[model samples]
Target: MRVLLIGEYNRSHFFLKEGLQELGHEVTVIGLNDGFKKVAVDISLDQNYTSGIKKKIKVLLHKLFNIDLHSKSIKKQILKNQSQLKGYDIVQFINESSFLCTPKIECEIFDLIKSWNNKVFLLSCGTDYISIKYAYDKIPKYSLLTPYFEGKGSKNNYQAPLKYLQEDFKKLHKHIYKNIAGVIASDLDYHLPLKNHPKYLGLAPNPVKILPPNPIKEIKGKIIIFHGINLYNYYKKGNDIFEKALEILQKKHKNNISIITVKNIPYNEYIKSFDAAHILLDQVYSYDQGFNALEAMAKGKVVFTGAETEWLSLHNLKEDTVAINAIPDPQQIAKKLEWLILNPDKIIAISNKAQEHVIKNHNYIKSAHKYIDLWNSAN
Candidate 1:
């Protein structure tokens, strides 16, 4: 089978491509570098002219005349690449608004792709109108929108959810959901909201390349806990909570624990810097783990991330023995950190379980087969 996976989220399509190829299927991916993460793709759609003076001018034009120069550029790029995008056995969009442009432009691109292939699946890997609406309306406790509901909506992270609630995004979401072959969730966060849809497919774990188990490093001195922060998503990812907890933990066990926080670094450098850390602090707002947490877990690192009951139930896991379930409470997070600091033996044990879990559940080959089954069934 030949598959065309469109858009990139944390190098997901890249890993899926690798797995599909290994399973004797041809796959091609087209996506942007996705900012500093620098995810690889076969056909790069990154707009080089959207920065500096050009960006300022574009913003001004959009403000004054309602002209979206960025969307115009993306539309042109899609038209130019239309020929190469066709003839695939299946095409999977990363989200409803996969092209990162206006909804109208996304519909245009989707119409073109749909005309070429009928088996197009939408992956619920990130925020979308349906999921955002569900989150805001249902207001699930300790979700990504928890901060927004709890009177901490000063950050820009809520902007996307707000925009998704608008009419234009609603139209796009309805159009795509109604026309697509099916929708699949990459985790419990997306799956829970999408599971009842008529065209909903089953959940597929995010694909991660399994690395050889690294020898457990002895905690000779201070334990190293690493947290990478993206300034734009700081509040959304609950970095402030993590930092506050870190400060408390540091004050209590200054000599025993060493906390390293890096802000807004490139993906390569970010991964390299955290390679030797004893534990990685990932997001606290999510109900399911994101790509960063899974990658860190794949490296045999004890990751403090979302392992909520919903996720546990989805995976049929009986206990919270894998990753630590991080909530929005700083005191609870500090307690987890303090416990890890005191019980060094448990860190090694959890690290081993983390790697084993990733290998068994999220390996690229196994995930690729799941995708194959979904696509075939949809067809």
Candidate 2:
């Protein structure tokens, strides 16, 4: 099989491509820089519009003429590479707005892909029309929108997600669904929203490249807690909640723990930034681990992320054994951290379990086989 993965989130498609290649399937990934994360792709779509006078011009044009210069550059890149993007047995989009373009432009890109590919599919791994609508209607008990509902973000900061609620995006959603083979969710957050839909494929857990186990050594003195932040997603990822929890924990146990916080770095650097960490504070609002959390867990770090009832039930695992379920409450997060600080042994045990769990369930090749089964079955 030949597969083309359009766009990426935390190098998700890159790893997926590697797994597929090992299984004797040809795969390619086309993706952007993902801003500061600088996620790699097989074919680069980055247009160097992120910084410098170009960015200022981009902003000015948008403000004055309703023109999106950056997006326009992206559209040009896509067209120039359209030939390289086609002729795949299967084509999968990483999101509804795979190109991060205006909705109308996405339709144009979709039409091009639709005409060229055998079976085009969608991946519900990020903010999209259906998922946003589902959360907007309060379908889940709590979601990334929890902060939004509590009125936390400014409109300009939320334009990416909030735009999914607009009519243009709705039409783009319909346009894709009307023609695509099916859609798959990378985790429970997206899976729940897509469940029972006619075009919905089952959830495929995010794949992680299992890391080599560290030699057994007892965690020393002050516990190291690593927190990485992406400013754009601060509110949605509940970074504010995590920050507040850190403040409380620091105030109470200043001498017991050390905190390292890095902001908006490249993907590789961000991963390396937390190497000494015994505990990784991942997102607060999620129903399953994001790519970062899973990778951290694979490295035998106890990760504070989504391991909720649905996730627990799906895996038939108990709470806090693999990863901590981080809710929206700062006080609750502080309490969880306090317990971990007190019980270093428990952290070690959970750390071991977390790595084992990811190896068994989320190994890239293991996940690739699952994707193969689903795609072939659909055919």
Candidate 3:
């Protein structure tokens, strides 16, 4: 089998491609840079697909209009590359969306390829417009109405308003769901909205290749906490709440513990940072696993997640071995950290349990084997 994976070659794609090749399948990765200028991994560039005057115009239109208009060009490219896709038994995709937030970008490509009668797998790596509506009950004005979202009207009011946005999102979901052959969740919570949808096929947590750091001598110092932030963007992954919590911890603890932000690290070095830290701060309010949290847990570091009771039940993680639940309150977070610092032995035991659990449940090689089985049975 030969598989072409579209999207950036991050930890997820790197691991998935390696696993597929190990199983005697040929895998070709065509990815754009995910901001890291120099990646240690060798990745191929599909300039014919992403570049050219037509695509440049479409990309500019996507930025301004929040719409995709390159389906005709992509359709031509697929027909040109039809032999590479048709000769292969399966073609797998990871993270189908372009950063411009248009569903039509990848949907058009899938439509072209699906017509060839070859097996296609779509890994819905993140939430789309419809999925966001089901989770948050509203789609931000900017996604649908770009001019209104960016201009003074966005600050004052919306022209089409909430009702119109809801209707538009629903229509998009109905159309795109019909084109996909399968939908794989990045986490258990990601699978729920599609469970009853006819396009639903299979699901798995985001996969990682590197195993957890081996047990090492505990660093002797104040407890170290890592919080990732991008000061430029203020949106839902809630960096503001994280900043507020840090402020409270600094004022109350007063030089007792060290807090660090691990942003802009090279992808390879990012994994090592977890092994050095005592605790990793996960997302705010979201109950599902993010890629960072899963990697941290695999390293045997204690993770503070928004693992509310509802989230736990939805994902079937009742008794968490590696991750600890943290409410949005800073006082609660500070108190939890204080308790862990005072009891070193308990932390060690939990860290060990986390390592064991990750290896058993989320190893990439093991997960990729399941993917192979799905492809074999797909046709």
C-alpha root-mean-square deviation, each candidate? 1.4, 1.5, 6.0
What shift in Å separates residue 133 of candidate 2 from its native position after superposition? 0.8
Report the lDDT tens digits of candidate 2 across residue range 64-87: 998987677877888899888889
- 1 versus 2: better lDDT goes to: 2
Model 2 ranges with Cα > 4 A deviation: 63-65
Please count the clashing residue pairs in each candidate, in the order shown: 0, 0, 0
In candidate 2, position 110 carries an lDDT of: 83
lDDT of 1 by residue, 109-189 (tens): 888888887588999988898788888886577577877777774747688666778899899989988888898899888
Weakest lDDT window of 10 consecutive positions for candidate 3: 138-147
Indicate which candidate wins on lDDT: 2
- How far does residue 230 in candidate 2 sit from its true spot (Å)? 0.9
In angstroms, how far off is 140's CA in candidate 1? 1.7
Clashing pairs in 1: none
Q: Write the per-residue lDDT of candidate 3 for residues 195-282, one digit (tens) a residue.
A: 6765566666566665635642465777778886533222244555566777777776656678878666666667666556777886
Ten contiguous residues with the weakest lDDT in model 2: 208-217
The lDDT per prediction is: 0.85, 0.88, 0.59
The alpha-carbon lDDT assigned to residue 30 of candidate 2 equals 90
